[model samples]
Target: MDLKKILWDFFFLLFETGSHSAGSLLRQSPQPRHTLHAGPRLSASASSKELLMKLRRNTGYSFVNCKKALETCGGDLKQAEIWLHKQAQKEGWSKAAKLQGRKTKEGLIGLLQEGNTTVLVEVNCETDFVSRNLKFQQLVQQVALGTMMYCQSLKDQLSTYSKGFLNSSELSGLPAGPDRDGSLKDQLALAIGKLGENMTLKRAAWVKVPSGFYVGSYVHGAMQSPSLHNLVLGKYGALVICETSEQKTNLEDIGRRLGQHVVGMAPLSVGSLDDEPGGEAETKMLSQPYLLDPSITLGQYVQPQGVSVVDFVRFECGEGEEAAETE
Candidate 1:
């Protein structure tokens, strides 16, 4: 045999005898070569676990992202994080909008009441900033008013739009402006598409009330900015609905008390599923923290409470499902 060939064979034999080696050399030689993809070159010496940890620390992004960046960067941790950031700026954000789903614990609610006919709507967004946007607030306002008029299942409702959103497609019924047209649904999608992330409608509710005495709205945690139009529904709405009835005068006082109760209580279902004929005030006896969540109970209180809450609805925006609908 030639000297080079002999030496190569001998080295393989020597390598195979080593205790601390993986059989990687033999594996590489046996695999087909054309399967390689054309992408940025990555240094093969980097450890994936260490590189993943580095990318995660550098970017407050997802763990999947760090892994993907490493794969794209050929296991080079540094280049991978940079490339991942760039990728987020490009096509990855919409998919990588995992951050958008965090607690919206902040949002705007819309309530519409005309005469005795009353409606309450809650629209949730991912952050307080977007929740306070002019267009978004307008959309929620229009939606609440729309629900007042078009109380139908959302399955067939056309998407909605404001005066200046990006929707130039004929598919959306909007008129063509420099940046507008399409169905209302298209318009909402346009918002998500333009925002480079996820945008949602949380939940929507429609309520109607007759002769009770109180019908006012209050929004908590809403910014005082004129640009933001978030109005909180529910507690304020429940109070309004409760007051509009022609119940006893004591009932109206009880209604106000219930409003205060709702603001503080945040009961889950309007009442307990076990609430039966003898149901006293479900919130009467509880201490302070019971009403802070939908779960748990304040039970009942005595003092011969005179008012009874009629029907009420609670919809926690984005709490139970994914986006309201898929397009």
Candidate 2:
């Protein structure tokens, strides 16, 4: 055998004999040591636990629920939220269903206007506290903005530019979601699950005026300042579209005043008592005394200004419930 082979054989023989020299050499060489105590593994585990805690805080779900949701979604935050919402709906639906009969007398009216187009939305919650929540306000704003933009885009395709109401089915068809991958209904469901309360997009309306007309909006009980043409009314809101015969007139100012009038008067229509639809006592907008004067009728107040009311929408929180109870 070669010298190297002989050396290797001698080394093994010494190792088998438990020679001190061979054992010392073997000890000198690096060998991986197995440890029962965790070091890096513990750190990794701690990071995961921290992440789980963070998700629980954000979602308002319990630790075990959050952990299970994260695991089910492969640690994806967005998917985990979706999963949690699904679970909430499955588990909480029976309880939530019982709440359907409960009156949602608290809510905020969100208004958005872009050019001659304006959108109004009423989102109702079970309590006033939820109405004041920033998240709920944001949801209202998003829904109003989305509705305004969507309606404006559809102006040419649809014959009428005004829709007085949007049912749940219609709302479900509107574009919504973080990626616009879903509808407003989906977002509402997610919010309902997260908030642990009953919520509804009670109503929505959109109005688009012609070039000679202008749309303005007013919000009462606003928690924040208005942005652009949008208004975040804390509880009540109004939208008014005014048409001017002369292009030189300041239509924006007139529209704003009209909107304020609508908000104050809670007008139902723009015509006189003769023109009233004769359904509800409060539906006669033109017959209502002028909010500013309280002497002249609203129709008379506007007739002298060379401006005509094109459309108007007034939304008061819990108004529907009041109407329902009366009926």
Candidate 3:
């Protein structure tokens, strides 16, 4: 009745039957390969290669550059990314400087508006073919929208518009989110590298209206269907600001009409010969014959409407560059 004796007798009976052997059972039994630490160490070279690939994918840098960055950072992914960015900044600025004096006669004007705030941006590339590129167009939109968003968030900084709305340095600092590697300048650099040509954020303007004022805009020669969202991807556009005594339901219509008129006439300013400062009589918006009704002057046409034109900005692509070249 003892347990050990009972098991021994049962095994002895099985061996006698000869259905299985102890040697065969021992051969089939599992055994430990080795100690955990005795296993192979991960390949450092493979890990470094993986980090290199990740850097290339995320930063859009050349494979050679990514590998060099990994090596420089001792295969640390985060440090490699930072090093790559520093290199990008250095290389981007160098590339920009080299292309600065090159004539950029072909590009698009991007515009965006939210509530009382609006922005206009001119982004230039070396060729018209590049201008039509979807990536380039998206860059223009991103820069415009990012700038508008930044300006709206910081009202006190809005005063900087007195000099100019944005400069290259300010644009380079804009937060462009993760897709653009955290800044507009980086996005631009990526574009330049991919397109193998020059790109410039030539100029930008921001307009914000006070209560009782309305801003309307129009675009001409858009590469795509002209809509409020993509209006800025056009050859020419105008932003017109109008002042009204009280908010009227018709103010938007009036502003839009004025915008269209400005786009057609390419007006220098909003006043007649008497009000304009030392300029040709025909250069003023109000002095020109109305676009809708050529028989009447613009001033005469708008006078009966009881609304006043406060300001206007008309942008024709390459106009400034043309003027500069002429001068």
Top candidate when judged by lDDT against the true structure: 3
174-283, model 1: which lDDT tens digit per residue? 22122223234443444444343455444554444434333333334433324323333331333323322235545535444444555544444444324432223343
Which lDDT values do the candidates have, in the order given? 0.46, 0.69, 0.71
Question: Where's the lowest-lDDT run of ten residues in candidate 3?
Answer: 155-164
Q: Count the backbone clashes (under 3 Å) in each candidate.
A: 20, 0, 0
Q: Tens-digit lDDT track for model 3 on 1-327?
A: 899999999999988767557566667744454434343444655676787788888777789989898889887888988898777767766787776677777888877778778777778888999988876787787788778777677645332122136766777688874345578887787677566678877667777876766777877775542323544578777777776777778776777778788878777667643453322346678788777877777777677777777677777777763211100
lDDT of 1: 0.46
**Which lDDT value does model 3 have at 317?**
76
Lowest lDDT sum, 10 consecutive residues, model 2, at 318-327
- Give residue 291's error in model 1 in angstroms: 7.4
Deviating ranges (above 4 Å) for candidate 1 = 1-106, 152-183, 212-218, 222-240, 243-257, 268-307, 322-327
TM-score of each: 0.41, 0.69, 0.64
| Shift in Å, residue 223, candidate 1 | 5.6
Clashing pairs in 3: none
Structure candidate 2, residue pairs in collision: none
